[model samples]
Target: MAIAAASTSSFPHLNHTLFPKCPSLSHHYHFRPLRVPFTVRASSAVVLERDSITQPQVTSKVELFACPVCFEPLIRKGPPGFNLPAIYRSGFKCATCNKTYSSKNIYLDLTITAGTKDYTESQPARTELFRSPLVSFLYERGWRQNFNRSGFPGPDEEFNMAQEFFKPSEGGVLVDVSCGSGLFSRKFAKSGTYSKVVALDFSENMLRQCYDFIKNDDTILATNLALVRADVSRLPFASGSIDAVHAGAALHCWPSPSNAIAEINRILRSGGVFVGTTFLRVSSTTPEILRPFIRQRVSQSYSYFTQEEIEDLCSTCGLINYTSKVQQSFIMFTAQKP
Candidate 1:
């Protein structure tokens, strides 16, 4: 990675007073004046002055981002000029739509569903089922208990396989799709495997809880962890930009699994890995006693895949080297973009 030298004229005059270094987090951060005021673009470079000897070199990650609506690279909206650091921690408006998203407590808001018919006209029950405060509470609090009783993959093996599957990449950006309550996303951030981990969920309440869960934690810093509210079907990332992607126990909830998987493949780099676990449809071969519970879970699910169905789905999405493991009613799988 090349550090964009501050001498370039493409950067804006950064107001250092307004954008002070975040001291509370204890992470290496700094800012310097941009020589040439410029908007964020594919050719744009983020230049920051070194505030300390220990501060890591600045590199451009904006190229990894895109407008969900248009698939165009997003430009940051600054008062007079924009700084990438400011865009990361505080907030920045989208240059295209002038929509503002903030990182309140380091939780990045990426959803554009507000004021749309789907949000305003949808029944309260439909929306609340996923984004309600109460549902988020249950997911954050009682989900573990529910999992234990539901005969899903236990946390131990689930996380172990996640670590194993994603163990290849040492650093770079990794996205956690539908990261409910930020459980594994925060865990992966704490482990220091990736330079950054994006915790993306559709529910604002879920992301709010996710921010609360890690706001005070020392190991998980804003530099490495970002909570983004986004739909899995239409990911807001640049093509072939993401290093890896992961989702856990949330695939069944997707409205269109095929579209979501296609989007996942679209964002991942050619060699990037995609790993996740989800509910598998129970069959007649399953024990009679477990059928009712499985059916109950599947009833709420948009769709459930058997092992063969999932493998075929991955293949259709252009992911190769597919591998799957069945544990109880859960299916764990890993594949890579070829």
Candidate 2:
């Protein structure tokens, strides 16, 4: 792969800080924009500078300003001040309204290149495949790609629940399992409510994405975010070693949620908190008709549990003082391990 020398401005070796000269054997990260037909690659940990054009370069910053639905910026209309190759300067599009962004904020990063085939998968034989497969859905939906998943009702509400649950709940410890990019976990990490913030995910790519978000000095020292890759049911830490456990949009992904829940109970200190969010079913409409179509588009999370079933599960596990609510299509729950 071609490499670039990140130089500061128009000077030669301006001697500015570069991303710590790469890290352990670097792995290429393949990323794809939603609704787009292409994938991009970032070679290893190479720092991308604005100068010293030594390698291929591109970025999603422009798309960030544009609408995903319409592929245009949400700002102002303009001929554009910056020049680009015909292919690179694709007009600005909005991610939500699909409108065009007509402002100066909509600039594109030219550091990214076409991604490799290694990170992609062959199309599933059947569209209903997502119903049974969890990881594949995550991999495709840009799990760690910063897609602003806050739009998902279930996941969004659960995040709100966790936000409130951990708030005012003084200093202790917290763990977020199957955390994708640790975005919601960042709430507690930023709240200063926990002594230790552990962000656990089964995918290293996910963890790398988390680091990408929390690598700044402020986060490292203030939140004390620790990245760990471990199964939800079988964590490497000792039993009862954790004080609080939180998960966002991860319940359905686990192969055996019961075991994971049980482990969560075991790991919490007598008053440690467990705040989590996961997808749940809202429309009881006939699954027969929508199931096949919906499942084909994306792995509809496991038929989300009803509020009653969730409460029952918590009760069966001996949880006390539980709080639950149904928002849109998600069931958000939190319980104390008394």
- lDDT by residue for model 1 over 63-84, one digit each (tens)? 3456677665554433221222
Q: Can you write out model 2's per-residue Cα lDDT over 172-237, one digit (the tens) per residue?
A: 667788776666666667767776666666654565555556544354434445555455666534
Alpha carbon deviation, residue 107, candidate 1 (Å): 2.9
Clashing pairs in 1: 9-36, 11-36
Model 1 / residue 36 / CA error / Å: 17
C-alpha TM-score for every candidate: 0.75, 0.51
Off by over 4 Å in 2: 1-160, 167-169, 283-303
TM-score of 1: 0.75
lDDT of 2 at 21: 20
Residue 209 CA error for candidate 1 (Å)? 0.6
Candidate 1 Cα outliers beyond 4 Å, as residue runs: 1-63, 77-89, 93-100, 104-106, 114-128, 283-297
Clashes per model (N, Cα, C within 3 A): 2, 32
